[model samples]
Target: MNRVEEPLLSVSERRIATRLCVDAPLGAGQTVGLAPQQAHYLRTVLRLSTGADLALFNGRDGEWRARIDALGKGWASLAVIDQRRAQQPEPDVWLVFAPIKRARLDFLVEKACELGAARLLPVFTQNTDVSRVNCERLRANCREAAEQCERLSVPEVAEPTGLRDLLADWPADRHLLVAAESGHAPPVAEALARAREQAGGRAGVPASAAPWAVLVGPEGGFTEAELDALSKLPFVTAAGLGPRVLRADTAGIALLACWQAWLGDGDARPPFRG
Candidate 1:
C-alpha cells in the first residue's frame, strides 16, 4: 500500500460528513448526476456550492470522492474522483415483518439498515391489519439510512407479499427465524448458539453465517393454524424472544440485533471516519 502512486487516505480525510447514495456509476474521471431531491438537499439544506466535496456510493460501485461541478435549485452534477473505500462483505440478514403504522415502519427500516440487515420484506400475515404498504417510501428511508450509516450497499426493500405465498416459494437454502410469542421454545441466543456449534461441527445445516430471514408477526399475533403451518416448514425455525410481549416493530428490530450479536457479524467494528 505504501508503494502505490496515489496518496493514502488520512483518518480525517476518510471521515467525510456528507455521503449520498446515487444511482449513477462512480469512478475516476466520470460525471455523476444527483437526483432532484438530492440536489435540493445539497443546494438548500446543506447550502453546498460548486467545488464542494462529498462522498458518493451506489449499491453496485464502491464509495468515491466527488467534487461538485454544477449546483442549482434542483439539479447538481459532480466529478467523481478516486475511490475512498472498496466494497466489502455484508451480512445477508433480512427483516420480514407485518406492516405497522407509517412512523414506526419508517423507524424500523432505518434501524434495520444501521443494524446490518441486507434486505427488508413486508409480509401480510393472517392477523395483519394494514392492507397496503408504501414501498417507495420505505426505499427512501432505507437509502438515507444506508448513506448515513456508511454502508457500501443499500438494503433491498421487497414488495409486500402474503405470508402463504412467501412460505410456499421460500428458498430451500435460506433459513427463516420466526418469533414465537405464545409457545415455549429455546431462547433466541441459546438456539442460535447451539446452532452455531452444530454448524461448526459440520452438521447438515450450512455454516452459522449463512443467509437468514427473521419474521415478526403483526399486533394481533399469528393464528393457531398459521403457527402450525410455519412450524411444519423445514426451513423455518421458531425462537422465543422471552416471556414479555413486544410490538411488531420492536420484535423485528430486537430479533435482528440478537442474531447479529450471536451468529451474524457482531465482531466486526464500524469503520472509523474521524
Candidate 2:
C-alpha cells in the first residue's frame, strides 16, 4: 500500500491555529489568568485541555507562545514561554458609517478590523434605519476578526453618534473620505490622490503619513442638507465608488479596500509567518 501525505495548512490558517487575544499584560515568564468567558470559549468551544500550547497577543505586547497550565469549569491559566512576534504599527485609518441592519453592521465591523482600520465610528444619518447600535457586540466582532486575521491590534469601536454632531466636532488635521453615490463626483482613486497632493503641499510629510477616515452613508445615501454640510467642510473629499450605487455595507468595504491599496499597507508584504 502507498503511504498518504497530509496537505499543508495555508499561512492564515496556520497563524490562527489555537490563537487568542487576552486583555491582560504579557511578558516573559509571566502567568496570565483567563477571564471566565475566555475560559469557557477555550474549554467548551475550542475543547482545549490543560498543557496545550496556544499563541496569545494583547494589543500592547506582541504575540507570545503560551501553554495552558490549569483548566477548570470556569477558570483557566496560561504560562507565557516566549515572544513570537513584535507588535507592528497599524495604519492610522478610521471608518465611519451609518448604522444599518444588525447583521450587516456586524459584518462591517469585522471587515473593518481585518482591513486595518484603527477606529470604528457609527454615524446616524437622516436615512439610517437603525435607531440604536449595540457597541459591545461590534467590539466583540472586531476582537474575533482580529484574532482570525493575525492582526496585532483590534480597532476601537465608538458609540453611535448623529451625523451632524460628528461633523461639528470633526478634527482639522484628519482627512475625511466621503463615498458619494452621485455620478458627478470624481473616482475614489483620483480623489485620494488629490487629497494626498494637497496634504503634501501643506505638510512636509508624504501622503501616506497623513491620517485618513472614510465615511459611508446609509442605503438611501446622504440627504441634500447632509451633502451640503459635508461639501462645505474643508477636510472632506467626496469620491464616487463606480457607475452604479452600492449597498451600504458594500460601499464601506469597497472604500476601505481602495484607500488601503493606494495609501495604506495593501501593497506591503505580509508580516505573518506560517
Candidate 3:
C-alpha cells in the first residue's frame, strides 16, 4: 500500500483559523461589531466564546486577525488584532453562466469562488430554463465558499442579465471564452493558448493586463441563433470541454479549471517577474 503525500499547506492555513466576510471596515486595533446573523453563526453555531480569535475580510481590505471581545444575546464584538495578508491580486477571470435549477446554480456559484473567479455574471439565454435568480443567495454562497477555501476576496455576484444585453455592452478589451457543446469547437486549452498569444506573449500575465472571462450556457445548451451571435463576436472564442456533453454545472467548473490552469494562478512556481 503506498501512502499518498498531501500537498503542503499555504501560509494562511497553519492555525486554528476561522474566517468571516464582513461588511464593516477593518484595521489594526479597530473594534468592529458583527451582524446579528454573523454573531449567531460564531456564538451559537460555531460555539466560539468571547476572547476567541478569528479572521475577517471585507472583500476590499486584506485578511485581519481579530479577538472576540463581547458576546451578547444577539450580537458580538471583535477587536482587530493585526493584518494577516495584504490584499492580493486575484485572476481577472469572470464566470458568466446561464442559471439552472436551484441546487445546481448554488453548486456553480460555490465552485466558481473556489476557482478564483473575480466575478460571477448570470446570463439568460434562449434555452435557459431558470429565468429568475436570487442574486443575494448567490452572493452568500460565494462568501461562504471563499471563507472555507481561505480565499482573501469574494467574487462579485451580479444580477441576471439577458445574453443579448450583455453582449451589446461587452467591453472590447476583455476576452470571452465560450464553452461550446458542439464537436467542431476547439479544445479549451488550445483556445486559451490562442487568446493568450493574441493578447500578448505568454500565458499567466498580470490580471490587470489580460482580463478574461468564461461563458457557460444552460443545460439544453445554446440555440443556433444564439451560438451564431456569440461566434460572430470578435472577442469571443468558442471552446469545447470534451466529446461528451456535460451538465451546465459541470461545464462551468471544467471551463474555469481549464482557464485557471492555462492562464491563471494554477502554477506551482512564482510567475515570471520580467
Task: Provide the overall lDDT of each model, using Cα atoms, as 2-decimal numbers.
Answer: 0.85, 0.83, 0.84
Model 2 residue runs over 4 Å out of place are: 1-16, 196-208
User: What does the lDDT read for residue 62 in candidate 1?
Assistant: 84
Rank candidates, lDDT, best first: 1, 3, 2
Q: Which residue pairs of candidate 2 clash?
A: none
Kindly report the root-mean-square deviation of model 2 from the true structure over all alpha carbons. 5.1
Model 3 clash count equals 0
Whichever of 2 and 3 has more lDDT, that candidate is 3
- Which 10 successive residues of model 1 have the least lDDT summed? 200-209
- Model 3: weakest 10-residue lDDT segment is 1-10
TM-score of each: 0.92, 0.89, 0.90
What does candidate 2's lDDT look like per residue over 1-274, in tens digits? 1101212244533343777889998988999998898899899999999877778999999988788999999899999877778887767889999998898989988888888889999999999888999999999899899888888788999988999999989989888989998737799988867765765633223335788899999988889999998999998888998888699899889988887777677655655553
Query: Tens digits of per-residue lDDT for model 3 on 113-159?
Result: 98989999999999998879999999989999998888888999888
Put down candidate 1 lDDT per residue, 39-145, tens digits, no spaces.
Answer: 99999999999878889999878898888999988899999988888887777778999999899999999999998889899999889999999999999999999
Best candidate, TM-score: 1
Error at 271, model 2, angstroms? 3.1
Looking at model 3, residue 225 earns an lDDT score of: 92
